[model samples]
Target: MRSQLRPETRIDRCFEALKREGRPAFVTFVTAGDPDYETSKAILLGLPEAGADVIEIGMPFSDPMADGPAVQASSLRALKAGQTMKRTLQLVREFRAKDNLTPIVLMGYYNPIYVYPSEAFLDEARDAGIDGMIIVDVPPEADEELCLPAIQRGLSFIRLATPTTDDKRLPAVLANTSGFVYYVSITGITGAAAPVVSDVRAQVARIKRSTPLPVVVGFGVRTPEQARVIADCADGVVVGSALVETIRTTLGTDGRAGPDTVSAVHRIVHNLAAGLRGAAARV
Candidate 1:
């Protein structure tokens, strides 16, 4: 467990605490049951060891609109194979038995949560050793009902902002954003390429001007150089599609993350970790 004694601190506090200690956090995202439960567990546990400072465990749902083809495909694969919210929480419990301290954040759409009762979902998440929840589709207008309770439960409720979000609306999003505000680097879905680097930097700057919360840039970041570039403007960079794509290619037509999959992800994370460290040095 973290020794700083802010168990109730929002997700941003966790990242801020780490930043004060002079280390950039590595956040990795993976579907709960793309390959299977055991594989999901492996990815979760392996992440911290593989240089991930935080783990974003994806709760698979049928309609993941925020996700691009890579993540959408992964979600479909997991759903087709029968992954549910309950099973995902169970995986968190299993992960906690061995590794107790690393922060685990659940990322997914709101449909699954809507299917289950909200308070019940929060209770289960707390019991499962989850530190936070990222319901991608939940808007700030619904914060009174959703984000507030999550904060009260001592679980961080992270929010997302896209390129289209305006100045007046950005603060509202930041106000409800607990962990770190997930600033989508581009205007489109998760895997689409960011056409201009300057635009992303400007967006990060705009968000930073309005809030003190640490901003983590994500979506369409596919390489170490890209991660490094994005990190220059934000506190953290999140890469999803690229990593998931690695998993897909490693698996043959018959769903399996072969030997190459693990090795590829390991290498990619290792390099990204190094790049983030380098970025931290510049700051």
Candidate 2:
């Protein structure tokens, strides 16, 4: 079945450019307002220059069930620092002012969007320069609530295809999915274990047979070596827990962003991007 068409977003363009360069995209994830707004913004502004091809800014939520400890803690820190839906959008708006080409995807659960009142949230998100969204809680079954509306408004509604997403369930998952298909390399929560390269290669092939959208693998991907191997088989690689952990470790004793917090995260991103560059693109 042919997938529905949506507006050509920054995400599509980013992947097109990466394909021409013969390398997988280095997608980074950081919590919006993590530690604090200023620190988060500084980190956001530097990502493109540090070699991130696509950026996934996590929206701080009280209960991010899909995430592991590192991302959960990042959310708590952001929320403690007064991160809100509006502030998250403001972060994107501010990032857009400096860099316009890198695609930005807001990733998190749906409660915040629901509370921001759905339609209004989509409008503001687009205006704020968000290219797509990864709402873990909203399934393909409930596309009417948010997915359809978001696509209609020009936001790519990215979907996740897990290890368990068998052939039977794969089509529905890809139906409304746009921008790309995020293949969760592991079966469990984020950052739980290392992804088997062979397993990832097989799963990515399976997903590719179903759709033409770029398939990026994530979960349990931490080091540059791991990123390189994963990127070899997928269109892109997403590093969330690893990046969030970098921020956590760089925080001052007072649990705030120290001087090195921003630079440390950017450095890690640079190394990861270098890994992607070194990878042999999948045939």
Residues 167-258 of candidate 2 have per-residue lDDT tens digits of 99998999989999999999999989999999999999999998999999999999989999898888989999999999999998999898
TM-score, every prediction: 0.91, 0.97
Mind giving the per-residue lDDT tens digits that candidate 1 earns over 158-202? 888888899878867887666677888777888897636798889
Q: Which ten residues in a row have the lowest lDDT in candidate 1?
A: 1-10
Off by over 4 Å in 1: 1-7, 10-14
What are the per-model C-alpha RMSD values against the true structure? 3.1, 1.4
List candidate 2 stretches off by more than 4 Å. 1-5, 281-283
CA shift at 239, candidate 2, in angstroms? Answer: 0.5
